[model samples]
Target chain A: MADIKSPVPGTFYTQATPDAPVYKAQGDTVTVGDVIGLVEVMKTFIEIKSDMAGTFAGYAVENEAAVSAGQTLAQLDG
Target chain B: MAERSAIKRLFIANRGEIAVRIIRAAQGLGIHTIQAYSEADAEMLAVRMADEAICVGPAQAAKSYLNIEALVQAARDRDADAVHPGYGFLAENAGFVRAIEAAGMRFVGPSADTIDRMGDKVSAREAAQAAGVPVVPGSKGRIETLEMALAAADEIGYPVMIKASAGGGGKGIRVAKNADDLAQMAPQAQAEAKAAFGDGGLYLERAIQSPRHIEVQILGDGTDAVHCFERECSMQRRRQKVWEEAGAVCLDEGIRDKLCASAVALAKAANYVGAGTLEYLYDSAANEFFFIEMNTRIQVEHPVTEMITGLDLVQEMIRVSGGEKLRFTQDQIVRDGHAIEVRINAEDPILQFMPFPGQVGSMRLPEGDGIRFDHFLYEGYQIPPFYDSLLGKLVVHADTRAEAIVKLAKALDELSIDGLKTTAPLHRALAADISVLTDSFHTQWLEPWLEAGNLTATP
Candidate 1:
């Protein structure tokens, strides 16, 4: 299993916006460089993209939760 | 007339450096200080410095700093005598002012009606015109149709700005060069405005080419007003002022007098209370200035004015809010020397100004004469990522603009904040630039300088 970690310390969101759908779902296919979520830091949004292709397992952190840099956000099954 | 009583308790309804600024002013006045913070900001410097601190809500500003009900309730419960909405969040929000006043606490700003009137672009333009202040010639009011925009563009001449009536922060604005451009761009601007602000109302203004961004600072006691000179904030990126200077060297003494007088006139016309700023777009070639809008709160660049004028604006504003009269006449307020303030934001300037929120480590601040640093940072403090990236302001003053630039460079070299990237290097480069040294730049100058990799190249 490969884990997707946040690149910055901020609040992580599963969707592009408050009213948008989740960028990915459980058991969905993940490709390299595919956007998985967003991390908002200091009022600027940075996209969190998948580095390795895999099957999306589940989000390890709750949506809109404060996260530290290098903290695992989602689990992916290789 | 009622007897004036000094505020016994002052509650700060904002965070970061400005909060610490208000707290210091309140403490100096022997007022009990109360600071409000979100869960993310509990460990901030202001929280530690205030006499008392309260957690308002969650990390998100919408649930905390921007929440009018939470802030008002907190202030009332604390038995606060006054609330200081420093600069942002609810500083300009009329509803917050009304709620604070309704709670029997002084809001420390202008009345709600004044905020509402000055907050709208069209209404503010009308107010400026009525006060005999020059404004950018364009539509008298909102242009409702494409045909109306076309006609207004024709009258205003070429290169007119089509802006949303409800827009701010450089959004919902499009510049049309000619008639065809106006016809094509107006519809798109209208549609974007409708989608963004839920109001597609648009206005037009003659776009001044490479205008200097100058603003006048004025303080009023509801009955009288006085101008505290002007600040030039033309060095901006993404419409955010990166560096600011007081007593803009670009204006001659004659034009400066007229500009400051017009600002005071507007304040008197509005019967303005507390501290406010009248923003203008100045055309250096024509020696003309047009009032654009009014910010009815203390600004971030206020220190430059204070540094040059030797007046504590925060303390003065609070005194006026407590039913005090203007302390000094316009003649008493003297501008000496030149002051410059550079914003030290938590961003990597080399990386296109990307936000960098990290824990503050060993910090070394510049000290001595003519140098001031206003910030809310402490060793080992973790900067919360949910807010703006402005870490602090490094202000310097000297006998002349040239000397101020020299002082800025020296102070920038002395200042250091470990464990986080900052925009200090950007200021270092700007201070050494020839155009900046000669004061021969405009509002559109900084972006091109950055785009040309000036920040990356060593001076």
Candidate 2:
């Protein structure tokens, strides 16, 4: 199992906007550099890209939750 | 005769440096300050400094600062006599102003009707024209169809700008050089405006080339108004003003008088109350200015005007909101020196101005004559990433523009906020740039300068 962590401390979102669909689902194939989520810091959205290729397990944090830098945002299973 | 309803308890319905600035101003006037903060901002400097602080909601601004109902309820609960919406968030929200007034708490700004009127681009343009203020030639109102846009473009000439009627902060804006370009761009602009602001309305203006962003600061007491000269905010990145200067040196005395007078005329005509800024696009080549929009609240660059005019704009606004008359006549208000204000945002200048929110370490601030730093930072404070990147504003004033630049350089060098990245290096480089030194830049200058890797070599 691999964990994807947020690169910055901010509000994390699983969707592009409030009404949009989630970027990924459990058991979905995850490619390296694929945007799994976005971390909104200081009103600027920075995409949280995957670094390892695997199957998407699930989001470790709830949508719109405040997260700290290096906090686990998602999990990936090989 | 109107009795003065003194604002004994002032509730600050905003956050960050401007919140802290408001708290200080209120405290100076012996007003008990009640600062409203989000859950994430409980530990902020302003929360700690205010006479009392209350948590309105969660970390997100939508649940907190922008929660108009919650803010009004909180202010009422705290027995606040007045609410001060500083700058952003709901500062210009007409709904919020109405709610505050309905709740029996005075909103320290113009009336909700004034905000609604001036906030809309079409009505504001009409108001300016009615007041004899010059405006860019364009469609008289919102363009409902492609045919109207084409007709307006034909009459206004080519190179017209397609702008959203509901837009601010440079969003929903596009420039088209010709009729074909406008035909292709207007639908996209409308769609974007609908998606962003729930309005598909769009407007048009003849795009001014190489314009300097000049604004006049005016304070009105409903019956009378006076101007505090003007500010030159040409140095901007992404339509966000990075550096601002008072007494735009580029304007000759003749033009300056006309510009300031026009601003006062608008304010008087609108029966404007409190402090407001009338922004304009000045084509220095043509030596002409055109009114763009009116911000019906105190602006971020207000301190630079205060520095030069020796006016406490915040206090003045509060006083006016409390049924006070105009304090200084136009002839009595004097501009003494040149002032410059550089925004110190919490962004890594080396890494594309990305937001850098971290725990503050040891801090060193420049202090002396004609130097003022407005901020909400402390030694052990952890900056929350839920807000904008503006950490502070370092303002400097001197007898002349050149001397002010010299002082700004010295002050920037003396300041330090350890354990976080900031835009200090960018300001340092700009202070030494030849174009900036000679005051030859315009609204479109800084982005190109940054794109050319000007900040890469900064030490």
Q: What is the C-alpha lDDT of each candidate?
A: 0.93, 0.94
C-alpha DockQ of every model: 0.87, 0.90
For each candidate, give its TM-score against the true structure: 0.91, 0.91
State candidate 2's DockQ: 0.90
Specify the highest-DockQ model's number: 2
lDDT of 2 by residue, B303-385 (tens): 99999988899999999998899877899999998999999999998899999998999999999999999999999999999
lDDT of 2 at B136: 86
Stretches of candidate 1 off by over 4 Å are: B1-5, B140-204
Q: Interface Cα RMSD for all candidates?
A: 0.8, 0.5
The backbone clash count of each candidate, in order, is: 0, 0
Clashing pairs in 2: none
DockQ of 1: 0.87
Candidate 1 lDDT, B374-405, residue by residue in tens: 99999999988899999999999999999999
Pairs with steric clashes in candidate 1? none
